[model samples]
Target: MNCRKVQYYLSTFSEGSFSSDKLSEVEVHIRNCKSCEREKFILEEILVAVRSLPTKTTPDDFNLKLFNRIYAEQNNPSESYLPTPESSWIRRPIGWVSALATVAVAALITMVFLQRPVGSPDLPLNSPAYSQVESTSPVSTPSGKHVGNRIPVSAYENIIGVSGSASNYRATNVSQVRTLRLADARVESLYVEMMRRLGAEPYPNMLRADTRYYEMRSPFARTGSNGSPLLRNAASTISY
Candidate 1:
């Protein structure tokens, strides 16, 4: 990109927001071009200066004036407060430009520096999402080999007694747990309790209360890395 184009988009780039793909292109241009690099440096220095300046209180009638201005402009499309001769504004720096730039610098500093990135989608404890990753077999690697899951379900979470071979077999997932429903009345009661504890609603939704249908349909739910049953030992009497 040329110096003019680089400088044109520099303000947006500096604010740390732009089209995602423009990142490397802009960075490459800015690093190679001395003039653009210097401009960026000067812009940063100005932002620092603006940050150090004390803030002034707005005029008491600022909002009223702004509303009136906007209303008048809306009524008359030709009428605008922006300078008609923007070329001069671009080529020549004036007092008004200095004030606006100061404001812009301050606003940009707040938006870019102080603003926090959004937190990622989390699988918090006891959430259905947490169960999707938990109580399952180890994740398979690229070479079709298994390393035991480093972030396995917390032992303290369920605290249920496990038969010696339960880990090697038995319900490995929500479907497996769901499959256990109506296998016996006592097991169904226990399943309902487990689902409720895992943030599932009770009652009419009891049969598949805690489980997303998609999870039940997922290939991962079908089998384990080892030959362990993933929802195997199906009950012949599925009342649901």
Candidate 2:
């Protein structure tokens, strides 16, 4: 009923495409709006001219030539006129630059790894390399596996991402570790019992897993916390 809708349907209205009620709505809008009325008049004139123009047939050889070109491409791929995918990718400046950069980074990583001449890889943390670590206390993990608290200095790198000697790293500093193992075990048991009141075991994953254990190791931190909790853990870890 609006001028916009009337102008949009003017061609269809000229062709008598709408039902009686819709036709009446469009006609009413065009008659009341002078702008829409002018649009309708121009549209009618164009349609009349189009209907009066002569129609021409396409060339009979057009389809045959198209088919022949497709057949030739199939039989002789190198002779095809179309641009190839591999050539097109290399032709674009951005694509070739990206490819070159990726290859350079890969080669750099391979050379660094192959040429490494630093200290030997360290033992696992639980191994007995922590000098003066006179005792070890076994702590239970969430999955019921036991791990030792005698973390050796050489267990991990002095600088995690750096490639060099372990002299600064192999110096021992850890002295003690305390954990609420009994409390966590008791809490897990209580939770299982409570959820089982529904006459079913708590779906395997619903029980508490991670338990609190704090280690007293220090020599100075390698990273800063920046006051964020996530960065706090990584940044707070102190070692030789």
Candidate 3:
């Protein structure tokens, strides 16, 4: 409220140590009182001047020179490296408990690492029977309904009916067609053949076969005031 209190709070305010309550009180006093308002303005100007002051970097050899002097003092038996009575408390051991705790943690970590196996855990993905089938069979499918150089059983129904839907969907994501799986190579060839049969313009990237996931780009996502999609491309699934 007074000049003394305001002066005491000035340093705290600069350090950002003032609570909301104290800040509110200071604001109220500064608003009502002309002298306090002038003091606050002066403090603000002081802060700006302090912040604008050119910062000087320490000399490169500063630490080297300081440590050299300390080492020289330590080597000389006649000269005492011990702290004076005024600063003796600082030289006394204080953090033995913290040092012991750090040592314990390091020891535990070392022990655990030494006990660990050399290689990563081999967690097999499929059963032994499935793996045997995968190794021996020419074509692989989990359902065991091999088409003998033909399409998979589940994909049989989709083959004939896919021409129109594939055309529409492929048109929408022609640029990203490179992300189809190796098995989808047959699908790509089929698409090309169907396009020729149906007298349709073939998509440039339609028959691309690179083993990767399809990255979907949606047009119906929400936008900001500027009309750009609020969310960028994200890994999401669509049931349909």
Q: Per-prediction TM-score, please?
A: 0.24, 0.25, 0.26
Tens-digit lDDT track of model 2 for 1-240: 778788888888999989999999998888888999899889889988999899997665444344445445643666877876655666689888866765565465445545643322222234232212223454334566444453332322221112111111223113211112222222333333333343333323222111111111111222333322322242222110
Model 3 quality (TM-score): 0.26
Clashes of 2: 0
Find the candidate with the highest lDDT and give its number.
1
Off by over 4 Å in 3: 1-16, 19-22, 79-240
lDDT of 1 at 41: 91
- What are the root-mean-square deviations of the candidates from the true structure over C-alphas? 28.3, 23.3, 26.6
> In candidate 3, what are the lDDT values of residues 75-122, reduced to their tens digit?
352476575453443354654654465456546544544554322111
Tens digit of lDDT per residue, candidate 1, span 100-133?
Answer: 7645644653454234332112223454434443
lDDT of each: 0.44, 0.42, 0.40
Model 2: weakest 10-residue lDDT segment is 208-217
Cα distance off (Å), candidate 3, residue 201: 76
How would the candidate models be sorted by TM-score, starting from the highest?
Answer: 3, 2, 1
After superposition, which runs of candidate 2 have C-alpha atoms over 4 Å from their true positions? 1-5, 15-20, 29-39, 81-240
The predicted structure with the larger lDDT, 2 or 3, is 2
Residue 200, model 1: Cα distance from true site in angstroms: 68
